[model samples]
Target: MTTSRGGDGQSSVEVGTFIKTPSAHIVEILAVAGLDFAVLDAEHAPFDFGTLDAMLIAGKAAGLPLFVRVPDFQPSTLLRSLDLGAAGVLVPHVDTPEDARNVVARCRYKAGVRGYSGGSRSSGYGEKGMLAAVADAESVQIMCQIESIEAVDNTRAIAATQGVDGIFVGRADLALSMGLADSQHPDVLKATERAIAAGVSQGKRIGVVASSLEERKRYSDLGATWFLHGSDQSLLKQAARALVRA
Candidate 1:
């Protein structure tokens, strides 16, 4: 994870970017651009195991903590992502404390029903041994996305859910659920604030996707400790547009 510096020379928040292209080259570019970490947007992008493996290998070589945002809260997907050596996993549409709990359970062997196997790549393919592998797997971060009004109302309970490391606000979906097209609407902001406060009160780190550096700072000020900005596809479009104008 990478922390951004404020005027005071201290970084209160960590920042990264989202990857949607499923390319190892894109992941390498993120590393060279000095990003601290990255999340493969598997929820929207199609990535087979070979592709994920390639990106994960690239991320490792670049010394970046690569994570995967699974399409759902399925235990098999979570387990497979971890087995692919993701630093963590982000599960989407977590609407209740129970959902959050289940996500965490899938990430850990002792607490939940994650099928254990030390022969996976995450365990050094048996090099690290089974006992040590279990411990390492347990340390992987689990981030639950709170994307609905129901989740916002149950924010405190979700944050307090054991083994949950953080809560990521999916503003776009939250906005859609509120019958709005703008995520910056007053109601959406209010719900975001409430979720942030609940996470802070429970001593859990809060996360959000920032469209710009300014927005990132704004969310940081609002107690969002983790921020993801931009994406491979968006960056490509912006660059291509600039080139056309040039």
Candidate 2:
């Protein structure tokens, strides 16, 4: 994880990568790259439960903090991901304070309604014991995705929600909300700026997906600390296309 100035200015940044496929090789590569974390894009990817669990196990073996981008804010979805040993969860389409709070509640054992299970993989299959599993649940990070116009409008409240660890700006979705195809448009940039400022005001870590190195620098300048470079499939396709041309 490369350290950058967080929205709070005092806090540091955490860098991560996103993967669509549940591939152990890809998880190992992320570990070798020394990324602070890796997120499995379950929101967009059709990952079967078995594959997802295997990927999480692979990530643990590699000592990489693995997170899951659940398709929705459903408690069961969050619970399943955590039960499988995810270090954290990224909840999509969190448009209001209530949404943010619900996510936190579902993620944390102390605050949320996540079911307790000591025999789960997160508890080392009963090796760590129930007490340790409870502690782990409390420590699980909850990142709320700020994407739509409503979410941008409520950024401050969302960031201030207790148990919410960070805010992730979904640039593509934000662009769609603004009726633009390009996330780099001025309108999207302005919205992201506002979201970042709001998150910073509350001392929350702000994250964004950078389409390129330039975009990463741009978001960093705006006080975004967590940077997700892109997805595994995209990178693989880009490399293959280049090789074909060469």
Candidate 3:
């Protein structure tokens, strides 16, 4: 999808949702629904590698950029997801510049440790040579999730790390870390603002998981360029509740 520029010359905000259900059809549906992107929640959802492979294929077939939220900082997991053809990977719990640097290293090939594989889907199934494959791999986005107070404090350094494409604020986990029940707690908001500002200072794209359109707008005004709204299951539940009410 083409990114439009806002009046202020910044890229227009992109809105996507999480995919919790392990279904390729669901991926197709999200693509047809015209969302900006879809992030498969591998960290919290029950998604087997085979299912993930199918979902990624569906996303590619339907023209949707699919990102995988990996369970952790495992290099093998990151490499496998990239090989499966995800547009990007959202690494969770990156609380320091050191962590960010390690993630970048694992996701790259030239100056990093990602294993070479020309047969992977990302490499056009061996059609692309080694040089082309490495270049394509380097183009994949790497978004580090800033979910803890420590991460918020280290936001600038994390964003400044070479090869980190963006920062995705994880408010729910941040709230839990802060010993709060509400993701919208004032302290959480303050920390999130600080993190966003830090990312912006480094000229990095900022992202957040907002619970509603209003919350999304609030963060957007604070310079978050992308948002992940409710997940597939959450949307289904909401629609079912509405149907019952109707």
Candidate 4:
């Protein structure tokens, strides 16, 4: 139900791209280009803790919100990302309400078991004081990814879970899990719609990775507010290909 607003104070579709290059300069460039956000693809990319630490710092310096897509549902991974000052986390393969609940439990403090460290960057290195720090940390966005058929069926419940800030539909994995080769296959589209609709019904923000402007519009029409258009690698490859053609 929450929307990202532009400088003009108008609600606009949130646009971002996947950060797979593992470069702090790339993160700065994306922010300078005016992207609404960026997700460091730690799940698929070779980003170690030190690398992530530098990139997160770059994102902060560039005035960009950087969310990390963690490799798994490990509490340690989530804890580390948050500790390093990631804006939020995109937890993948959250197939059930229990999984969603577990994510919330791991990321929160008062209501869950997130380890506390006043010296961490997230707490402003003990400058913000414990109460203010806990408040800010708990405010970090927590999005659950719906990637499989089972996840689609439970999308509503997952969105309905408290502390779940949004639902991100992972169509690529959904297609593969459904035995399809195309992410845009009709069945995949249908499942995407179903998941989005379920999240909307629960009054949750919806997000998706759209390969093209048309694809982004299609999902936008289906109630997806946040869109990740492509990855740094894909965009670079495209620019290089276009340059060679030119």
Model 4 weakest lDDT span, ten residues long: 1-10
**Model 4 clash pairs?**
none
- How much is 154 displaced in model 4, in angstroms? 0.2
Off by over 4 Å in 1: 1-11
TM-score, per-candidate, Cα-based: 0.93, 0.92, 0.97, 0.96
* Root mean square deviation (Cα) for candidate 3: 1.3
lDDT of 3 by residue, 65-171 (tens): 99999998788899999999999999999999999999999999979999988889988899989889998888889999999999999999999999998999999
* Candidate 1 global lDDT: 0.87
Candidates in order: C-alpha RMSD to true structure: 2.3, 2.5, 1.3, 2.0
What C-alpha lDDT does candidate 3 achieve relative to the native structure? 0.92
Best by lDDT: 4
Estimate, for each residue in 26-118, the C-alpha lDDT of model 2 and write its tens digit: 999989988889899999997877888999989999999888999987888988998998888888999999998888888877756888887
Candidate 1 residue 7 C-alpha distance from true site, Å: 13
- Tens digit of per-residue lDDT, candidate 1, span 1-246: 333458986447777888989778898888998877889988999887789899999998888889899898787899899998999988899999889888888889886788877778899988998789888877798888999999999899999998888899999999998999999999999999998899888877789999888988888887787889878888789899999999
Task: Single out the weakest 10-residue window by summed lDDT for candidate 1.
Answer: 1-10
For model 1, name the residue pairs that clash: none
**All candidates' lDDT scores?**
0.87, 0.86, 0.92, 0.92
Model 2 residue 113 lDDT score = 87
Q: Where does candidate 4 stray beyond 4 Å? A: 5-11
